[model samples]
Target chain A: MEIKTLSQDGVTIVTPVGRVDTSTAKAFEDGVMASISACNKIAIRFDEIDYMSSAGLRVVLMAGKKLSAIKGELVLINMPEKIFSVFKTSGFDKIIKICQTFEESKQFFN
Target chain B: MATAANILVLDDDEDTADLFRQKFRHQIMDGIYKFSFVIHPEEALDLLQQQVFDIFISDINVAGTDGISFIAKLRKDYSFMRSIVISAYGDINTLRAVMRGGAHDFVIKPIDFKDFGDTLAKTVRVVEQLRQAEATSRKLSAISDELGVSAQLQRSILPSNSLKKGNIEIWADSIPAAEVGGDFYDFFWLNNAKLGIVMADVSGKNVSAAMFALIAKTLIKSFSQIYTSPARCFETVNRTLYNENATSMFVTAIYGIVDMEKNELTYTNAGHLPIAAIRHNEDPRFLECEAGMALGICEDIVFTDSVHTFSPGEMILLYTDGVPEATDKNGNEYDYERFSEVLRQNAIMSPNLLTRALMESIREFTKGMSQSDDITTLCLKYRLRVTPNVN
Candidate 1:
């Protein structure tokens, strides 16, 4: 998995570019941690993530809880349908906030 | 090596700087070395922070900071660069200070042009060797990472957990050796009433064999959907494999189609191991078949098929040779006799427990020796719902 970070209006945008399965889940975690230390408002764009298994979900949960502890916010945007279903079925959608577009996600930080 | 080597020089004397330019005139003209000079030690320290240099050449004392203290700072931070200290004093204390400060070499002033040139050449040689070693180490790490990803990719291609469809509960498990193996097993619904099952073993080990196993599995599956008849499916798969067989590898496989409504299983064997089945209240026995040749050989060979009616509470087991052929520390195999005996004894158990019992028995027999081949097995139990009578 490749992680690209962009900072826009104090919100960190983390874009992961591949399957977030068991093998690459740790890399995803590290990428999130790198972006987490820099800013409080974070947005993870899942447009390029093709397949995500339970391992990826675990990382997402951990990121959510960590950000919550610091009174920071994390929003997921542009999720592909397959990965969205996995999130919904696993009940992660209820715990983590998700949005359909970048503008909507940015409003959470505002 | 073609790019000019960046060299940083710190000396207070102007003539010494001129001497270096004159001495390395040929190398500088050839574009082999690029030189940068700093008259003050503090200025050199600031320059060091801004850019990287291949070699550091400094005198014992400069305008503001001493060479030993500067060398100490450089060693604490950018220790990878080579440092050569030039000094007018040849005392043992000065030599010890230079060495303790992490200087690569110490040269006395009143420098000889020939000696200086030779020293510079040696320093550059050492720098090149270090770069080459670091590059090789990085390349090796990249290759290791790619292999790890390949292994994980291979694992993801396999079916996860057992599933119950129609009247059959199917469980398949495979434990690959330390290296990747060519064992493969798959089951999918051919229709609402029929389930297609496949178990195969390719000829070799490692990546190439695993790739061949994938191709063979895919071809057999696609062929089964098109042909329907077990024997005809094998024939078509064999012909396709023979045409595409570039590695000269062969695959031993057995394909079965189970019809839930008819309670019948029709199967074809391609030089694979005999499957064991336990009918209701009967001892486990190997299903009989005329063993045909493995696929990826000759294209003209025809395969034969066998049929068995599976009653409720009956179970059938399919496995690769890795099970019976598993070896002990004394090199004795578990053998087909013992394998069948274990199945016969545990025939009444559920498919999941039975498979786990067999795996545990094999582990006990092997005494934790490294596996030589992949051990794969599939246990399919035909379960019927028992209806309680209400009065």
Candidate 2:
């Protein structure tokens, strides 16, 4: 998976591409967790992701709990509908704010 | 006593042969053992090739040949025969060289005839035991290979269908701790809009458990197609398995049916781990289900189904005890507290990553420790379309 970190408007955006399964989940967790520690507000852009297993969901959960511990903010932006349903059904959408576009996620920072 | 063995002795001193004959005269007279002596290394080699001697005794300092080299050559050609080396040089280097040359043991020359018979007896017993152990090890390796092949076949039974149905994304995985394991997970579409998911753990390991797992999995899938509720599906499957469970083995399972059109999940637990639900914006929490008897334990036990409506963007997670019960080198279990904490931490990730992340946490906690059970996780994300559709 490709994780590109973009720091714009005080938010670190982690965009990972490809399928995140058992083999690559650790790297994905490290990338997002590192971004979470460095910045107060982090946004994971899911534009390039097409498939994610429970392993990937685990990284998100860990990042969410960490951000919560630090009173930091984490937002998921531009998640595909298929991916969004995964977040919604698992109750992740409630804990981590998700938006359809960067504009919508920008509102969380405001 | 009947003659028990034949011993070949290779010594350069011609008088040594007569010394052995006198020393073991009682044993020879009793027909307990027979001894033969060769004055030259070449003569010993020629005799060894022609006759099968039960044991070989060689003197290290022969007139024209080194005992160590002769033993090494004997090992190269007749390795199955055990040998003992005797030398006047009692130094550690000579002892090590003899051993490296494949001598089963070493003896000092100017041979104490009194101790010689006792030493030879012990060596023969040890060699017999070694032969038995090697044979057992070969048989064990063959059984292990067969188990490996069966494990591969078990993995092949997992559903290969694309996990996506409408907006629901389902993913499941199982990892065995042994050559074969009792844990199994599967997901199948009951109909166009209904999905069936199963995660089960049998009570034991190896081929017996794997065979039962196959039977349980097949029965569950077949009964699920005919039964309407998760409780009824498990009830019928349980009766079928209980009648055939002569070994008294049992299986803990969690079976769920997802109504995709209505975004509802109906599930039942058979003495399995509690299911977890992660709601958007809220921390992940374990869902409580009615405590029912595990399958194959009783024929008349009743199971109850719990229903939970999927609020858009909610996830349902099911796993075997291998997750919470994973232990560290210190023997402390990973436990539900750590599992919940891990789930809360990785709550924002996708389904695949979520499961993968839990496995990573378990792996980290249990580093260097051997797992005793199979680890398995099944996750379903319910996402109905924005536009309404009929069920």
lDDT of 1 by residue, B85-202 (tens): 8877787797797779788887887877688778887888788777788889999999999988987788765666487765788778999864677889988788888888888887
Structure candidate 1, residue pairs in collision: none
TM-score of chain B in each prediction: 0.68, 0.61
**What are the runs in model 2 whose C-alpha is more than 4 Å off?**
A1-110, B1-152, B388-391
Tens digit of lDDT per residue, candidate 2, span B255-302?
999898878889998767678998777878788777576787667878
Residue B372 of model 2: what lDDT? 60
Interface RMSD of 1: 19.0
What's the residue-level lDDT of B317 in candidate 2? 87
Residue B133, model 1, lDDT: 88
Lowest-lDDT window of 10 residues in candidate 2 chain B? B153-162
